[model samples]
Target: MDTIFYNVMMKSLRNGKQWEVLEELAMEMIEKGIQLDNVSYSTIITCAKRCNFFDKAIEWFERMYRTGLMPDEVTYSAILDVYAKLGKTEEVLSLYDRARADGWEPDAVTFSVLGKMYGEIGDYDGIQYVLQEMRGIGIKPNLIVYNTLLEAMGKAGKPGLARSLFDEMIRSGLQPNVITLTALIKIYGKARWARDAFELWEEIKSNNWPVDFILYNTLLSMCADLGREEEAEKLFDDMKKSELCKPDSWSYTAMLNIYCNGGEVEKAHELFREMLGSGNKLNVMSFTCLIQCYGRAKRFDDVVEVFNIMVERGVRPDDRLCGCLLSVLTFSKNGEFGSVLICLEKANRRLVHFIDILDKEEATLDMVKEKFREILNESVVEVRRPYCNCLIDICCNRGLTKRAHELLYLGNLFGLYSNLNTKTEMEWSLNLRSLSVGAAFTAFEEWLRALIEGIEHNERLPTCFAIHTGVGGRKLSQGLADSLSLHLKKMGSPFQQSEERAGWFVAAREEVVLWVRSLDSKSLLATA
Candidate 1:
């Protein structure tokens, strides 16, 4: 048969989704000495792409180029999408440049695919360039293109930009679909714009727009993060009521987190049981949230039980879960410590070793520090702060003030607590906002010693000094601030509570110096 006949037959097969047969017919055509034109190649490439046969699509695209028959815009877009799906950044860019040079103006579909690729790689500038080029070519962005851009902005955490684009999309006379609303919800969620997210969700409901699983889950997760227990419960109920959507594992996990954050352990447990009864497998996050809730409530037995269940189900604990387990150890009784330690050993051996060293009375500060450094180096960065806080809290509970100070110092050395102390020309401040109560006290003691040494050496101190113990939101931090106030009053320290600040104590330079002079050097050093 001639090339036209082969092309017609292949296009029919491609439309029927017969990808394998289509490819075989193409090979047969080649063997019969039939020259494949651009249409024939485009049909084959599009078919392979639709079937997720990315390698086959690339092969046919290369073959088309080798035949010296330039691909039209459709083929270019198809192959570009294939390259994008494969994460072939170099190939995507090179082909896009070649297409533009050949005078192919990409349509909305092409721009959407490119926007997705750029978004995945965190190249916001490239997405903007795509938008600008699309406008320059007089091709107004459709719903698909706008959805892609908004999704990218969400991932980039540019909520403002996403809002503007969403507004522009509506003004362009294209109705917002579920994908568009879902992207906007995600942007608001990521940026922590709770008010905006809730408002948008309300609008979505008022308009009675069709809501899918992703849209419902996105809102639920946002509510979980913002600790909007009422809002999350409402969203979860609405999701259940929707015939088109049901609570998946992530949905249950998010709702469970909301309950956990609100300290509604009974509700969390009820929902967790319901989730398991529905045959939705629990993930590490679900178990972590449950353990955290149990830890906070001082229910050590429940924490261990949930952990045992997680192990039985073969859900290997991650670093965050291990960190949560360590946190439980801080509140655990001396006898209860060993039980949590067992779970920690199963989760992460390094953490177990670190805890073991800290528990050992004979372990020197150097040994604990060495083990700490090793664990910090091996752990993911997000867990480092929590691990340090838990360890310092544990030490303080054990009356290991000196060891706690050394660990806090090592945390600073690792740049985990860089802003614990800050100096300026007008004010010198010690920020213990992120530190545990015990670590904060240890840091304050160290700062006082340094102040005395500086005064003895005639070093220039700031005109005013402030100690920040953090605000009144956290129970432990507020308790520390209150205790520090009482301690300062009992010692006749020069520092006085600032009337304007809830957690700040201030002292003038001369008062601080005199206070330091009056403090017995041996007594202060002995306290350390």
Candidate 2:
């Protein structure tokens, strides 16, 4: 009678009426007083799960425990699957822990779920851990378990290791499926190990294996990456000839991507046109591939045209695309000045999100070299002095210090980027003492120390003339750090001084030390 009722509940589950079936079973159990066991409780739990009624499944599972019926491995496996599918990995693991703590070892299906979840995050070790535990428990793995493990290893770029596992599975009398072979193709392609992909591709074909569209699509994308256009075309032809599969938009996009990347944009455009007639909607990524081809060919005008086409098709341009277009235009040899200016203005408009009104003056510099030398001599970018000092500070650090200094004074005369430094005065450099000889030496030492420490830790600090001189100023604190640290020790230590000079040097160092100690390092770097 229990068997008959179980079959009836299974039928309701198959027909998608788990809740109604559970309701009928509860009434039957109540009126007939049928002896409830783990199987009976699990049957209702499985039904509740079918309707995504996890709350009811837990409630009935508790009832089963109360009736002295413990859940077996299969019952726990079912619950784990439901949680995993809902992307509640935390809950899935929690349930697994509870089932195991209660002394129920997970079955093959449970191992499969846990293996797949870890695989999603590139955790190949987790899959192996599960597999080893299964073997230790004397439970042999099914083909699904091994296939998933092989795919995870392949996707993680251990194709050679994955192939070894494939052979092991064969030795264990299990055959790897299409999913395993396709993953091998991807790994080989990713590593530019085309020979491996070709060998595996041939093996899949020679075995008369039933291949899916995904398997061919992966190979096509791999061939594109490998610049194997000849082979990619042959595969595309074979895909068309195969009666079992149809060409997908992804396959077409792969071919077009390869052609465009191979300096054959015309072919890519031609194929893109052909695909439209076949009723395929070119997704944003595929369209992006085509646009990149135009950018590569330096036909940037055509890139604009294609962008318009995208807009016409109701495909909105994303921020990354906008940024790429701006970068390309900035580097264009003969870009229209008006257009470039328009883009700069637009980009600046967008920069309001990350910029303060005072930050827009970052480009200004208007002091003459005579004026600049006077300020350095005096040790400050004084009130109403041109921003020429900051630019001079930055460019000189980049091996163009003299040129940067010349440009800063020249720009000051002409008022280019002159408004830059006027927006905000940095707080740290504000009250710094005069640029004494001793103060210069101390900051220079800090720069060199930072470099040694950076190299010791395998880190890097930007060293430029503009960088050094910029921090050397009294306003912003970091100009000196950029200059000497990045340069090959332009500033030198006066080790040749005699003991008589030592007293004076020590006295001077103490005074300079007092000045820098009063400044904030955080605000120094922030403004710098």
Candidate 3:
């Protein structure tokens, strides 16, 4: 009679609508002196996970263990779900090992979760192993398993393999769901196999599957990839009308890209403003399209304006964003250079301030980490190699060696490579106007050491040249110029006057060049 009552109570709890109701029922059962069995504990844990009450789920697991109850594969899988939600990959793996040790074979749900984890991390081999192991245990691969493996293959750059698997799954009589079709479309889209992509899209439409946001986004992306702006626009309009698929930031970004790349800047700008007014949280990618569009049109004032507003809105600029802005500065006419510089200077100062805060003695290491994470999340750091090079170049030109060196060090720590061009740009930007001959030589040596240190680990050593010259109307004295030339010649570096840029002495070694402006006749050399 008691066992029958226990089973009845477990069933009621399992079917409970809310986790709170289940918890209340469990407490009531405990007060009534009812013994909860393994089924009872498992139901509670599963319910807690479904409700996102991970902490409560963990407590129930611990309580079950304390009561000397062994967790079944279902119980362990439920616990793994909780850990997966918490993103504790190690714990998930650890529990998997424990389940195996306890002689509990994993079920399909367990395999699915493990496969999904492996797929996410691009561990194609692991995903395959999980699938094979499931078969070894007599568990047939389900549609979810096949879909996950296909997606994993695509992500791992084995699109051919992914397509083969998709065909295999279909032949095995497993119906490809919407997710399956989307993943296949993405693979075809990425490879620019337009025919295959369209074929798959036609299947989706023929099936009369409910058109959702993911499907529209995927199709729009495919159209964008094929440079079919008309088709992409039609899809976008259809997406707007669909009650099921509301436009979000990603969808907007894809459409914006289609317009921008098509040279429809006005349309892109109109959509951009609408996106802004839509109260969507714009990410860095969202702004990059318009920035690049303005840059392509040489509307630099608009480029700078957008960049300034991006920063003003507290959007942390990434390397791509900074690179876009730098490209603007690099191509800007001399008359507009100063204005661009002013905007860049403002942005740079803000970055420097953040760097300074990270250096404060009172800021704990953990706090520094938190701040760095916040900077990354908030879109303020310019960490891309090109952008870092641009920042380093500006710092070098402005005689901010400490800041430049710090940036170089940070770049190195961040695994940014110093390419030959990047190194040359830095050396080219080095100004020697303020340093005396002796001071200039010392500065040059320090710069060379720092440059070499930053790029030593790179697979290819880039030949670099430094062009250091006096400021406008100020040139190196004859004696100092000659001394510098003699030093280069003594070091086996070749020195010759550049016929093109007057007063410029070009010296070359095996991989490094030193360009010195000589005022041997007291005439100022043009800045390179």
Candidate 4:
């Protein structure tokens, strides 16, 4: 309840009004276990702004986030309106940019605010740009944007360009109502071009369309321009007397121009009053027309008075505003290069970082951390080839060494002979594959011979070849058939000692043991 009292006081400060103590108590009584919904939070932000509590509203929005509540469309719309009214358009656009990052889409009212602001600044190009964006997204332009574009372009003297827009609207199946047609007529009338203006009038007439005062006024102006003054007066009288429509600003401006040109200055001045009195609050264009007329008639003082009135009504001259007092004079870069070079530098640093990782052989959790950092850096690298080369080197180098002498021992245990030359040649050539297999058998037999010799050198085991032999499971004596032939071949090791110098398993693996053999006399006689 005490906290509720503080909140009510804050609300009062926001609204520029006072709160009752009992109302705070009642609000606290209504507080429930449910924290707050998005709707209630959004409403609070909106109400804060309506009370002119901008900072309070922003603070509340932040608090809502901390409290896990989301603000919705109405909340943002109220804030946008406040910004527009305060002329803080830049801040308004910046917030929207941030909102996009947060994934919140601004609705149409926001776009409408932007459209109106652009229209006020006379950014005719901006109008088209907004239209293009809206159309690309399939957003239907509402009356405010559509009509404001027409008025802005019409005043800017681009009615011919705006005609294509009319066809587009019609193609969208919207009828050109009286308001739309009137804007078109005034656009053509301001340019004093009768072709499209009168054509649209005749199109309306032939289609049995209801012609309003704007149609008749534009038609009368066309007549006066073509020297059909009598017809112009007839149409003016008819439109002003009609029960359905009366002569408005367009009519009076046209008629006054006619009278003033015939040197009927008094009648023209009367018509001007009647025009202003009849809900035709003169705009800047109205006064501009009057100034042109007076200057043509050589009424310098009247032109000055009208110009003064134009400024007094806060209609300070637009581009067409300057008269004689006239004029004053007024008077990312390389962003792609910067962006591309920054990307290149980042990529180069990434390659260096990867090379460092390959150089470090220590393994632990820190290695995993380095690996993940490399992944992230590569994501930032934006270059593929250098990153690929770094990875290939890292994997190949790590494959070459894991621990001290570990590769050689592990290779022997697996019978793989982890020699890089063996692996590479085996991988690249079929002939090397056969050699690799033969080499494995050779190493195994050599290892077996070494084991047997080492045991015999210690005299721990006897040779079984002479002690007990078997011929298909029966004991047998030694054979004596080739004893003499072996003696001769062994002595020829003396005759062929020069040839024995040549390699033939060194030729003495058999010769030295054979020469040491005693010649069996029984075998010599058997040979004879």
Candidate 5:
């Protein structure tokens, strides 16, 4: 049979989804010396794609190129999608450029595929380039392209860019669907723009727009993050009332988180019971949130009860949960410490061992640092800050000032704390914004000693110096700032709280130098 006959049969089989027969016929055509043309190759490549035979599609694409036959627009788009699905980003770019150079205009489907590929790799610039190229070629973006771009921007944390794109989509006379609104909501949530997210959600409800489980869960999760207890309660009620959707495990977890964070422990416990009665599987996050709530309320017995329940249910404690348990240890009474340690041993034995070493009088700072490093190395990166904070707080509460300082220094050495001290040409600054009170005190003493050393070596000092103790947002941090203020006054230090800056204490260079010089050897030795 001629090439045209084989192409016709292959096209029939491709349409019928008979991919295996299609491949066989393709091989028969090649063996029979039937010179495959562009049409024949395109049919096989399309069939390969439909059957998820990406490698076969690439092989045929290369074969067609070798025969000096350029793929038509449809084939070019198909192969681009194939390369994208295979994650061959370089190949996709090269082929896309070749197609554009050959005067092949990308259709809406091509643009959508390219946008999705860029989104997968988090290449925001590449996604923007695709949009620009589409508009440059007089191709207006459709709903799919806009949705892809918005979702990508949301993940990239570009809320402003996402908002503009969303507005432009509306201005282009395209209707904003649930997906579009959901993406905007997620962008706002990630940027912590709670006001914008709530406003958009209100608009959705006012318009009676359709909302799915994912969208509901996204909003509830945002509410949990922003501590919008009232809003979350209302939304949870609406979700329960919806005939189109029902709350799942994630919905319950998010609501639980909201109530826990708001200190509504009774409400959280009620929801927890409802979740269990509804047969929803309990997870680590739900347990962690409840434990944190109990810890905050100083309900130590309840904390132990919930932790035991979590273990009984086969939900393994994650790093965050372990960190949470360690934090509870800082506030726990001596009698309560052993029980919390027992629970922590199940989550992470290294943490218990570190605590045990801290209790040992003979345990040196080096031993403590080594164990701390081991625990940090085993834990995930997200838990590092909290773990360090909990350990430092524990040491401080136990009156282990020297150990706390050493641990804070080790944290700096491990790159957990950065920019604690910064020197610019005009100002030298010490930032204790993220430190606990005990850690901040040690850091301040260390900074003062460094200043003395700099002066002794005749190193030039900036004309002004500032120490920032973050005072707003967190009550605990406010106490830290207040303690530092009192300490500075007691020591007759030259640094004074800045009236202009809420969290800053500034000192003039001349007074600071004089204060450092006047310090006797005993005072200096005490700081050391």
Candidate 6:
């Protein structure tokens, strides 16, 4: 009957209805006065943990103890696992203490869980104590124990300790597995210790250990970070040629990023096609890489093309991609106003096309306004704060003061994102420069006229910029919207530091033009 109950409960747990089955069985047992055995209680406790009902698990455990059934090794291990995941380090210690006091020897599984718990909390000494206790009890440390300790050491930034542990494991006649190697590789890669990482790779190859997909992917990522495209390509090819291992989605993404970062768009595109052909679902990072690749080459058309493909495929554009699109549309490295205008106009059209596809009747605006409307809408996509900042600057540069104020309104509705600094900004400014083809403003008056023309509109900030802060929008404090408006109004001042505010004040010149354009309204200055 006990064997039958256990089997029935196991099936229920596997089917994800463990709690219901356990409840019914417990009632039946109690009504019949069938004394539940250690196996029955242990199974209930284990099932509760697996189902993530920690409270219920604890209840079952306490009831088992009250029933005068002393837990065996499996029960102890299950409870220890629950405590570890809950970060109940104190409870774990208390359990360990009672088990030892009651003359119960901790087994390999128990010690392993304890070691992992200690490692997670950076309690290296605790880990050492656990190992010593295991040895004292004559229970030998196994591969799983070593791997957990090594991973903890790596996470704690104690690479030296991890290496020592690896050596100790080897000296004990236990071979390091792929998990062990991957942990060490991650540590070296993070520290940028290329020599050690390569040495470990060579050791793995020489020892005839199976070079799996994860190992290759890890090394490829390391190469990408270190800017070693040639080596990354070779590793990628090796993975492709290997009969034992097949590259997965991660493998293709890593190689694509490597090629893109190296400015080899052609190669990146080739691998992208291969990834698509292999039936691996391409992720947002894949599309992000390609957008960044074309942006680097100043091919805004390609950037928009890829972005269209991404949305059309139902892959939502994230904040990261929004930053990329903003850069591609706004910053032109070559100060050719003509080319910049042309690119902006083309991008503007593409964005409008996107809005048309969405076909929301509520989005009633011209091409430029609708484009921004879609960009800032969180229900559509969660645009990051940095992207918002960039778009604001883009609007300012294009003489879309109303549009810029409108973005500020959206920022208010969406809540302004702090820590505006990001890598995308650096990449944008570094590659973007002036492309010259237009007439030089030799006269001050001519420059002033041009500057005013760029920012002639005198739209009220609050009225035009107000976006409905719905459930998805972040609620901001009062006065933030006013402050943002004031800062933008001051941008047209001759004293406004365009050089310091790289994204905002790039093209405008002349004190009068700057001052005039900075007004809240043309009528305000006129009335004054």
- RMSD in Å for all candidates: 5.1, 15.0, 11.7, 38.3, 4.1, 11.6
Candidate 1 lDDT, 459-492, residue by residue in tens: 8889999998766422333666887788788878
Measured on C-alpha atoms, candidate 2 has an lDDT of 0.58
Backbone clashes, candidate 4: 0
List lDDT for all candidates, in order. Answer: 0.85, 0.58, 0.66, 0.49, 0.86, 0.63
- Model 2 Cα lDDT, one tens digit per residue, 1-528: 865675566556636755876657665775787766666667777777777887777777777777777788767777776776666777877777777788887777788877777666677777677777788788777888776776667656677777787777778887667776776677777777888788888887898766898999999988877678889888989988989776788988899778876868788878777776767676666666776677656676666667666667776555444444433343344434244324334433432221122123343333233433442333233412223333333233334433443443454454432222111222111111222222233333343344344444654322211111222211123433333233323322221212442211111323333433444545433322
Candidate 6 residue 127 Cα shift, in angstroms, is 3.6
Ranking by lDDT: 5, 1, 3, 6, 2, 4
What TM-score would you give candidate 1 relative to the actual structure? Answer: 0.77
List, in order, the clash count of every candidate structure. Answer: 0, 23, 3, 0, 0, 10
In model 3, what is the error at residue 351, expressed in angstroms? 5.9
Give the per-residue lDDT digits (tens) of candidate 5, residues 166-226.
8898789988787888888989998989898988888888877778998999999888777
Which window of ten consecutive residues has the lowest lDDT sum in model 4? Answer: 324-333
For model 4, give the RMSD to the true fold: 38.3
Off by over 4 Å in 3: 1-33, 51-76, 83-107, 134-142, 152-158, 187-199, 202-210, 219-249, 258-287, 301-327, 337-387, 392-528
What is the TM-score of each predicted model, taking all chains together? 0.77, 0.57, 0.57, 0.39, 0.83, 0.65
Q: Per-residue alpha-carbon lDDT of model 6 for 1-528, expressed as tens digits?
A: 865665466557636756767756775776787777887788788878888888888888999888877899988999988999999999989987987787777788888898888888888788778868987889878999888888777666777777888888889998888888888888788777777888888888898765677888899889877777777777878888889777888888888787877778889877877887887777888888887777767776666667666667777666566556655555444353344334334434444344233244444346545565555564234445555555555555555554554554555455553222112311211111111001010111222333344456542111111111111111212123333335435543332324344323222224444456455554442321
* lDDT, candidate 5, at 4: 84
Highest TM-score: which candidate?
A: 5
- After TM-score superposition, what is the CA distance of residue 6 in candidate 1 from its true location, in Å? 9.2
Pairs clashing within candidate 4: none
Cα lDDT over the full model 4: 0.49
- Is 1 or 2 the stronger prediction by lDDT? 1
